[model samples]
Target chain A: MKCARCLEDTAAKVADAPDGSGAWEIYLCSRCNYSWRTTEEEEVINPEKRDPYFTLDGVDMDDLMVLVPVPPLKK
Target chain B: MGCMPACKFKPLNNKRKNQGVNNLYRDLREFLAKLEEEGQLVRYTDEILPEPDVRHICRASGDMPNGPAVLMNNIKGYKGKRLVVNVHGSWANHALSFGMDKDTSPKEQFHELCNRWDNYPGEVKFVDNAPCQEVVIKDDINLFDLLPLYRINPYDGGYYFGKGNVISQDPDEPDNLDKENVGIYRMQVQGKDIIGMQALAFHDISIQLAKVEAENKPLPVAIALGVDPVLSFIASTPIYYDQSEYKFAAALNGIPQELTKAVTSNINVPAGAEFVLEGEIIPRQRFPEGPFGEFPGSYSGIRKQVRIKVKAITHRKDPIFENLYIGRPWTEADFLLGLNTCVPLYRQLKETMPEVEAVNALYQHGLTAIIATGNRFGGYAKSVAMRVASTPHGISYCKNIILVDDDVDPFDLMQVMWALSTRVRADKDVIVIPHTPGMPLDPASEPPGMGNKLIIDATSPAPPDSVMREVRMVDRMPQALEVEKIIAELQKSAGK
Candidate 1:
């Protein structure tokens, strides 16, 4: 399945209902880290139904990533 | 505008003096019971989808006048699970949290909270056992199974624990009670046992993490969920770095806060909390987190934040999961942080400037603050505004400071707009200082954490700075107070 936010096909099934009920499944995108459950609304799970404003298509993931520099270890 | 009569004010409901009951709730369930008894909570037992339905109800509650806190019991795919939202979403609920009359106005609540804040460093009672440890999961810890996790906003990257009272201590001063910090930060459930926490550079947790990371040691933490209402409020408050939040909670409630040691760490969490997830922040590790809707009404961009590996989960039987819905302006996030935000700024300003009357930092967590103060001299209002920008929370959040005459009620936006319309002269009243420290979540910040700060002095001219000609101000009629009292009596008799 494709990620709803970034349209990436790297989404993978992460977990099922702990009850082993096959009631719902959670999927996480390896590319953008977006996670959603199968029971979510179409707007959240379906890429086509996603809001364009939140879509990360054509945007560089590196540009959006904020890497806070780790402070140096004490000597 | 003419000021109202002083007779309109109602006597504060001082529970401590009248009934000897200080609004100290032992647990979230006790508070929820009080909310239900007072007609401030709505419960749903119908089976509802986890997504959209829960959030839509919560979002709609913010639009109602003093909306009720929503409790959902029967969520699809999750059996015997309970979730609550908007627990502190309205002024009425906020007042009720303090055991005050539900009709208490925001201005009155502010004064009551300030009065309680004066009695700082209250007592804390340590305990050997707590209800939060009734059910402990040491192995096969899965957050998805433990929590009824659901996304608040459609664009949010993952389900977040938005209201957990995260307890941690300074690694260097591990035994110092004062150095222990209990704060609330957005925690994203990244995996079954992995969580990503947004620990901003300025956050107290970040300071503790730095000390541990420098030595390549994991920082133990306890994220307490469904805590007492007052504990949540005190956790969100920006107090001194060394001040203990449990003590603050004690002071706010006029009683000793009860705390218990975490299962795996020395951190003390509220003994009455419903759940406590014991974990440790992996040293020098970062994980992709966020794109979550923040209190600023904007989605904070994804960032590589500190990662935590959950080792255990302890909870009361059938624990209730509490989460906050933050989207746009005036959600539960606003009400939760509103008056607590104002009291701090008011105290800081009143310390040096006695003429400072009131502070309303309810908007976007004091990104913009409206301060009412009596001017001591010309440009004194501007000086007060500058001081606001330097306060602990203000350093990063107070980007726009609006100053008004002491008579103006800063809590009332209409009164504020009147001052802005009549008192402001663009050329002289506006002061802009660029390239100042700001909150990164602010969408307007250029470099994320840096931006311009603005101060608008709306007070009338004092001695030595008369920009406009003196005009006689209109005053209320002498009989206005008597007439208002008569009308109030008539309305009461008519059941209006």
Candidate 2:
């Protein structure tokens, strides 16, 4: 696997996906210590356990804040 | 059990067949043998210094899934003096060391432990002879030359006798074994027959010493090293002041604890211990000790601590020196101290709020706690947080208390963090106490032993606002076992 930031062949392990699936994996470039995640979808995402990020809306400040790095604008 | 029963608890999974009864480890050697049999012990033949090198390996090795316990056979300077580190390193190994079923869930283990704090006086058998007293050296005592004492951190003051239990009886009740207190305190080797022991002011030993010093008398003590592995856990735990650890240990193992009277003092030492240092803490003798790395993951500055004049040294033939690294996370201290704090706190919290699902003392550091409860009333989490922070056993050294909803698993750091990030608000959810009792070693605290405490109410909102969460669940929530199975299958296929 190639790291997105370093563009070098890297080692990787399956990481918890944003949607909680085994499909996604995180790769790390050993030389530069850069990492990125990729997904290999094998099954449909269950609505009850779908990607929390997918359901996020600007008005849903709490969930949106959780998915993003920064807090949402005041209501 | 003198204390009121907090909650009705029965051991979980009783319907599951009981594994055949196995003998509990009698001493350090037997515990090592058990670990070896289970393929959980690794020995290093290469000579390593008793200082940073051994601790470094222990710190690194503890991160493995079921990390093997380390036994260093050769020391850099000391000859024929073997050193054992990290017998309590791994979670699996730690559970096994205490004769607990490793397959059971952490919640089940907590339930099983809830009733262990009762005041039942179990058998403490005293034999006429003991292995610890096989070779008694009353004169010409040189601690450095005889034992391979460890200097764990680079900035430590001097060589320390780590992982030893100091046994002392209340001076006022000289003849009563029930009033005896055994605690794990670090001893810095000062000279041929003297060592500085750090028994902090909060400890029961300090209280007993204060009373003795007021009476103008020295407190008799026997420091036992390399004892039965279970006793180490018992000593590290916060058994009430009135309860003796010997009895608690005896009750926990369903076996009698064997003790031997020290030659130089009336105090009793574990009969199966590898070594015993008989000594007395003089009425007013004080010496500078520490600036050493403590369990809080920081250095505690130098302070005046009581010094012990070693009157006699007793040990078995070929004694193994057991040690532990105090600083940083993911060490044995985390597991021991975490359970010690969590079990009692869970019981006490349950007495008030039975909805408390679980509690976790994050590291051996014991500064932070993660609690899971079902309470959803407005300001309920605040009350839960306050109760946990003020409980005598819980608040002693802890600074951060996080309360999560019942759906969150407190033991899993990821789940707890997820709750904190998704459910909590800095303005509304965070409650801060301006000043409270704090651990002396925490560098952030302004004064040595006093600081602020933070309560993070990470629980999901109650009533009308609770529905806003969208009843979310991670798809991978139930895939833990599947993930483990797949990983094992892949490793087997890859011939790893």
Candidate 3:
């Protein structure tokens, strides 16, 4: 399977799923160095992302939020 | 009305360095600009409620890598004013506030903090004119009508200054920083002219108040809000009674803190503060204070504490209101206290066992820790672990101590868990201390200030080469890179 993030085909089985039924697979792109969990549909579809002000509580977002800079104080 | 010209020290270079930061920013605004420069500050324009939305944003951003401090400019009721929260919520931000690179590790940060403690000298220089005095209101003032103090939680007693750092001095020695006490105490707005302050019986401020009360004198205080981040961290730290936080702040900022007299009291306040509440806590009076959310993720039930009778309110023309929210594990309070708390414990352990590599405080109020050290003897691990569990004030509150070998990274949760699983024997490694000094906010403490402690020696007992649990290591180039390439291929094969 191809990586969802970088559209690369470097996917492999990382571990067995918690129920031992579905195997957990991960896709890592060498170009951008982005890693995605293939077994978890959320990380693939709606991966945790930072908002300008808030991230939904209880969700661990991977990216740090970027803030707009205000005018600096002078000496 | 303004700062003295002589105290205006030049701002230091912003370049990343190893020896620590040189100069403190001029004021809170300049400090916020520095956080913005480092990409550690975030702004929210959403018209949020006063209760949970603003607090939720702080918790979410505060739990991240170098915690992005949140600035909420669009509150439901307050339009022209801004509320800055979680400003010191990340490890990287903590280092940045004190003049270190944003990438400095906890161990290196600790070393720099200690070095500042050793060599930095602090002085409090008075100024004549200050911004905090730009607008003074002494009469016909109602707190609810004048300021936008939010009720963060449902069961909170009332609106509060969650991040107000109180500055008080010994009545006898009112001018010296040595007798000055600065601490972050929760202030519940009890009325238009009064606020209930919780100075826990164990705090130095409480001790100072007790001394003043014996002589039947009101302890004068100045509550400072929206000061620079470095001073805020210093106030939140569990500085020893004899050590002055103001001096330490000056040292960290590389200049003397500009002080100005409060309108209602003689106590000196940071001249650059956005706002200052001048008041006095009467000697024998007590008022109902809390039922407010505490740092330990629980409500500190109602108790009668000291009451501050606000006599004057002074602030900058267009002041920004600053706050810190309690409750939950990884909020700003935890990060602020965690960074400073480790320094004291390190000093305590290093006095005898200089082999201690580093200490990592975990969760709210540092209730648990992972200590890295060299196991010199079979029982040396337990002995050091005992000191970690029993040390007074800040770290003594750390009830769970996990001792690991020097090779293990204390900040890595998985590595700590692995050490616990492999090196620790349930019966042999666990040592329980029955009764010890405790944190009042801990929900599990039996008598509120007393609790049991557990020390797990996670260090290996086997010889260097002989290991009980076999471990497999992965190489970086072919094995890891090939896995990444495989995952990329898999994602590509899967539909868009």
Candidate 4:
């Protein structure tokens, strides 16, 4: 019902829900366009399944850091 | 100390919020729809449970899509709360939220951001208590009760705070000092009394946290639930020790970000903020924290973490909890916070290092910076490269830095590497200094912030007395006309 931040205005929608259930209202001001993605009341959010964080070892940071090799210079 | 001038912005309540998905809601919501329309947001209404296994779905999809946003409608716990995932993870999405073309380049966007932030309002106001205070959960607080705090990745020891901003005060400075700073630190929830907070060593926030520990004092901080979006950029904005986020947020918002006195401690919270966690880090409260995935594309196994005593919990009647995932590219952490702040940094670097031409937050803001400079002499590119990895604006977020010459686009690594391969001789052109320093999440280095980094100079070699080449062909007119037709055709095809 109430908004976060200003806590004055009413809430409308959720920005990002890890779980599919909880309501994360989009906090915004009708005037300044100061908007953010947050969930005020996260009763139960069904977060999407993810991989093991350790899987990062499966790939090299260098490889991921550099998506493509920079080509050599031209004449 | 002065009030920030006003801007044309207004909250998107009645005018922007609640509009039909088709009528086009605010910039952020519309972008969310675009992600759906583009099939980027996988509408997973699957009957999923809130087990750590839930992370499998996102990992199974490979890396998150860079162009379109991701939205999951069906969830297991807290059925009343709706969740939206990965909204500001890529440049495309962040651009759309701020009313820019999805394809807007980082160089252009960062320049605009610095300018827009300059107009940020600093005049602050306050209310006794706001949304975050609406529902008070004092004392006997158990964060697990805030369900859905599951592990986001395989390496992660448990659920972590990857995207949210951790607002803390600088302890080295006087409590009431003018230079109060607030930074976005990764708070990985380790246990009931402890959360692993990765405050980069080079940063002031971490230093302050250390100071409190030195004297065995609890560091009080407010983890904002739902405040304003610009606060993210503000959190990422470089600070001069103990600089109040309110001042920077005020300037960034083009109006003062109102503050409310904390009920549990002597901290100021944004009046508009949703949930405010009034907690203190008991000195030397250490625990095993991570093994969580980070931007450097890796996760460091469990390590000693910090402690945060939950003194009070406040939020709106139906507060929305914000969370994000790491361990891969295209997370909002990479997009909005990473690349979002790159170009402006390149521009800022130029004031001190003119040779610095361009910089970009590539692969989700992990350094990978592509620069273009006219390296006139020996070490010209090296000096510039070093600064890229060490400067508060540059090195603070970099895991790997690649410096190029004027000919490189900075946006295109292919161009930068081409310059490196040809112009730079391995030992001569490449500058790899170990312990280059970076974020704690960079698992490749020493623990978190204590690590080394490498910088490769990809600039072209200077001419020995300069030999002339064949006369270049100038086809500007034809090129412009050809590009014009392609743009027109694409616009018409997309029905724009």
Tell me the DockQ of each model, to 2 decimals.
0.56, 0.01, 0.01, 0.04
Q: Specify the poorest-scoring 10-residue window by lDDT in model 1 chain B.
A: B1-10
Give a tens-digit lDDT track for model 3, residues B245-364: 778788777777888888977787889999898889876756445557888888775555678888899999978899887776667788778767776676667667775766777456
B-chain TM-scores per prediction = 0.95, 0.88, 0.85, 0.80
**What is candidate 2's CAPRI-style docking category based on DockQ?**
incorrect
Q: lDDT of model 2 at residue A51?
A: 39
Q: How well does candidate 2 score on lDDT at residue A39?
A: 27
- What digit string (tens of lDDT, one per residue) describes model 4 on residues B8-108? 11123343222221222221233455656645555556656444434655454435445344445445554544344555655655654444555655555
Candidate 4: Cα lDDT at B465? 21
Q: Which has the greatest lDDT? A: 1
Winning model by DockQ = 1
Backbone atom clashes (below 3 Å) for every candidate: 0, 1, 29, 95
Candidate scoring better on lDDT of 3 and 4 = 3
Model 2 score (lDDT): 0.69
Better of 1 and 2 by DockQ: 1
Candidate 1 steric clashes:
0
Pitting candidate 1 against candidate 3, the one with the higher lDDT is 1
Candidate 1 per-residue lDDT over residues B1-496, each given as its tens digit: 1111121222355453212237557789988999999999999888887787888888988768999899998887776788999999999898888877788889888877776776788899987779899898999887888788889887888999889888999998988988899999989988788888888888888889888888889999999999888899989998889998999888878778988888888888888898999999998867678789988888988888888899989999989999988879889989999998998888888888877888999999899999998889999999999899999999999999999998888988998999999999899999899999989999998789998889999999798887577788787476886898999989888954
Q: Would you list the C-alpha lDDT of every candidate in the order shown?
A: 0.85, 0.69, 0.70, 0.54
The better candidate by DockQ, 2 or 4, is: 4
Please tell me the TM-score of chain A for candidate 3: 0.33
Q: What is candidate 2's lDDT per residue for A1-75, written digit by digit as tens? A: 643332344434423322233433344333322222342121111224433332211222122111001112223
